[model samples]
Target: PDTTVVVGPGGSFEVPLNPPLTNGETVTVIVTDPAGNSSTPVTVEAPDTTAPAPATDVQVAPDGSSVTGNAEPGATVGVDTDGDGQPDTTVVVGPGGNFEVPLNPPLTNGETVTVIVTDPAGNSSTPVTAEAPDFPDAPQVNASNGSVLSGTAEAGVTIVITDGNGNPIGQTSADANGSWSFTPGSQLPDGTVVNVVARDAAGNSSPATSITVDGVAPNAPVVEPSNGSELSGTAEPGSSVTLTDGNGNPIGQTTADANGNWSFTPSTPLPDGTVVNVVARDAAGNSSPPASVTVDAVAPATPTVDPSNGTTLSGTAEPGATVTLTDGNGNPIGQVTADGSGNWTFTPSTPLPNGTVVNATATDPSGNASSPASVTVDAVAPATPVVNPSNGTTLSGTAEPGATVTLTDGNGNPIGQVTADGSGNWSFTPTTPLPNGTVVNATATDASGNTSAGSSVTVD
Candidate 1:
């Protein structure tokens, strides 16, 4: 992606490169025409004339665990791990003095390593010998806390403790039995992470151990089910479930079952329409998130009956809710559901009588029932009838028995009226013989005002 311009016919160009090229390197360049046809590529090599500086200051690591040395940068350093002095494996030396090289099979205290350096062109330097370091394996750590790091290690080895940042905290030697502990000068900060290592008398260090301080809180309890007073839910096993009312007063407590299922019966009965909170605590006094369950013992509002009384009782209630109709004595008369529209209806086996007292109640989806609503049934009229004595100037009828009869002239002008006996019969004769061809009609009304058809009679 570099820009260059060349002239036509006898064109030639030069490509520029940045600094930092190594000796004994080669680069090839190719020229292409505007149509992408390529010319022969030209090759060039940079000559290597200088050898690396001699290796120096070769020495053993503090613990003699590895070979460390200084050499010319970019030189390969060989470590004779088996001490035969001819290099076994060679490592590229980084840009520093006394860099460490790990021994595959770590050298024991009595073992030695012979190290040599070589330049890129294969020039070798004089050899140096280093003794191996002795160290125990990393310690097994557990239950370490604010002040103490207790664990198992090689018998009589010392344990060193440090914060996660590798800063020293404390150190202690193991007992003859291989148990060791290090107590920091001060308690470990809550939630701080710490690392530990084991060391032997030979000045070697083991791998570091890492641990995080534990103060984790438990998970919150889950409350479920329709009734708040009788709650069912999950919590940590063996934890205690403590319940409290909205006022923050203790209501009761119970232990969670082995499966983490729990139930608590409040010392005081939880009333409807109250909010309550529950907390779970482990034996260690670690509390779980607060679980809340609101007491909703309240049913629904008393259902009202439209039209007050009828074969079918209807009213408004919770949608998809169960509604019950009861007599004054609290006996269930009928049951029905309030539709999704929040409307409900119930019809009893026997029609309710006039002035009868009844009760209406509504239930919520949660099974809460409303207080009974008092309803007084209104009266119902009796059935209608037919008349008799069609042509005698006399009025007679078989209608509702014990009904009252009102007679009128053909034009509907009222002439007189009478009450029917229990046999359902009624007659009304003119006090004087009727004038020839006069017409009369009569209607019968029950005690409840249910009326019968009219009877018309002509004079004899």
Candidate 2:
């Protein structure tokens, strides 16, 4: 009989009939069938073992506790249990898979950090998260100091303090015991108003106290001219003299001395016409006021005569000449009468004498002497002028040559005439030359209006 088996192309084929094939078994069968005769048949045996298919669907727990599902037996499991973005801890899965990833320092509040679990199969898990707490509120602040000028504070006449916003801080009066203070809860920002105030507990402030802080002193009182008033001697020079004040003061002092002198120097200057208590104090301090006395500053007047003495006897005084005397102030003091020959004699009532430098005045009933006259009385006479040509009996003098000579008196009166020849000698024939026994007076006058004294000649 013929038999045939079908096999895939390019594929290995083994066949066994009926009983299972064993190792080393061999069999043959005829080939072609259907219309033709077959050729050969073949036999094969199966081998024993083969590897199993790779495992699938590996996974890890969502809480990162452990890994599960099918995987290779000795596979590694890892977890970033701290969620610190790294796989820090590891576990080896024995034939049954399990692991414990301790919560890495337990998660913080409000944090969303990631946790990863990686398997030996190279797979990772999702991240884990936690949250944290919020921050606290800010605190309040305040500041203060004791006083403006004194202990624990600055010393000044004026003080100003300000607040954090540069606003001035308010103030309150110090206690009755004269103490000042301030207290605050918290520190102030830089340049905040502290406390600046002053307290004068004793209340002893001077009117000038306002000047003390600036180191200036008070002004002093002023004194006037500082010298005393002047005094005079004579009432004719006037008595009521006024002393003027150089500065402005109220009270003044004035006084007059025993010699009719008045003056004063005041401690402070006073205004004009300021009434004063004038006390005339003696060396012993005995004082008087409103004393009455005559004041005089002028010299005594010179004595005078209507017809001056030694005045060439012009007319005889029938009623004996009278002379008047007066004082320097032009006030008449007294008069004196002259002797019988019209001689005048006058003695001043005042003892002051010649060269005494006084004003002399006289008034006649005709008012001709109304204007006063100044007189320096000198009773002494002037020295006589000397006579030049000697007293002469006859002049035997020469004349111009060949000229006629004329005899004349010393006053140029012609007494006689004579003629002379060329010799210039002339002799008078004396019709009446200078009468004998006559005493003739001779005066020579020069052309300069000077007259020499007369010379006497006795003719014999």
Candidate 3:
């Protein structure tokens, strides 16, 4: 190497080599005083060829934006982001062998990058490899239930909630299990939309996830009239409806149809007076106020009827119930309400004919009617018979046809019995002759068993 003159402070002077000297080469230097006295020549060695150690403790930013580590002091750290065996960026190690390099177009998570350390001597160490750190993932949001919002994310991440317009609404952190929840300060109207993002400790934010809010509860259900095991109702379309007993035990569940109609049949029959409760819930799990109905499955008992007397009919039925009377042909005769004691009486506007059949039924307060009870009218009695004067041995009388005449003496002693002929005539001959002046009395009984007043004649 040729010598070149260099000027510096008194303590030390630096010399430049005209043709750069190779590593580990030797050079000779000569010094002369200001006066004419020469000094001996001295030999000096150039930098050695040994390379510095590769970067140690290398770490990449969670977002892959930067690389940092320790290296030999004064060593230059070169970063190869693409694994192409070429440095894309470099940084000089500082006093404590610490260096950090910022990367443009940062590496992605799990991407491999090569690092090499070179000292001032131009010697390079073997390349070291590092992987970009992973970042937090987007948060998962749950369906809104008209009351609160909740979901999951990476553990320890901060959750940022925003409205559909990108306005910040709330912030919270995930628990150790990556679960989180939030209740809005005020009610969100139905069909509101929101967004959520997860931010890591390194200030890196994941992509935003959009969520639709459903905040409306279904309307109260309208139950239909029912008296059997099955119940049906109307509610919000597509709502889930539940059936529960008075005590809140679950009975069954059903989903409403497009027309808002729903039905459910219990596994077992409910007893009379059992209260059934119904509730409707929308898709977002918002529940409506409960509605209730009482079961009235039992019908009134059959009425107890007395035989009709052509003009009036009477019966016993459930208290405070309505009793209706119908003829054998099912024509309405009359209706009356039973008293508190369950006794009812109905008088026809027009007198019913003898032998007319009357049927009675009682309807209770719940409008349930019992089976019919029937009775036949037999109010007329047979006419009195005419007894002819007779001797002690024989007696005769005129009575209604088809009737039976029973004869007796004036003392009320039985004489004989006889049936009337087609011409309404009857005769009875005593097995023993009656005494003189004994009175013969006759009475008539019609086919319906109605008896007439007696007529008397004196025996000659």
- In model 3, which regions exceed 4 Å deviation? 1-125, 128-130, 220-238, 246-267, 283-285, 289-460
Which regions in candidate 1 have their CA more than 4 angstroms from the true location? 1-79, 82-86, 89-155, 164-169, 174-187, 219-460
Per-residue alpha-carbon lDDT of model 3 for 186-260, expressed as tens digits? Answer: 866777778999998988788888778777677899876455477888999989999888999888899999999
Best TM-score goes to which candidate? 3
Residue 254 in candidate 3, Cα distance off native in Å: 5.5
Error at 68, model 1, angstroms: 5.8
Clashing pairs in 3: none
Worst lDDT run of 10 residues, candidate 2, spans 206-215
Order of candidate numbers by lDDT, starting with the best: 3, 1, 2
lDDT of 2 by residue, 222-322 (tens): 11211122222211111232332223232333333334444444454333333322223322222233322222222222223332222111222223333
Model 1: lDDT equals 0.72
> Candidate 1's residue-wise lDDT over 1-460, tens digit each?
3434464566656566565346767777667778988778777776664655655666666555567778877788888887576787777988664456877666775577777778877777767777655557889887443656688999988788877788888888889999987667776766778788888887778878788754455699987633454766789898889877788987778889999998766555567766778898875456788988777676677777765434656778767767877778887788888888988877677777777777877777545788777676654543444556455456566666777788777777776788878887777775665566767776776654445667677755
Per-candidate TM vs. native?
0.31, 0.16, 0.40
Better of 1 and 3 by TM-score: 3
Candidate 2 TM-score versus the reference: 0.16
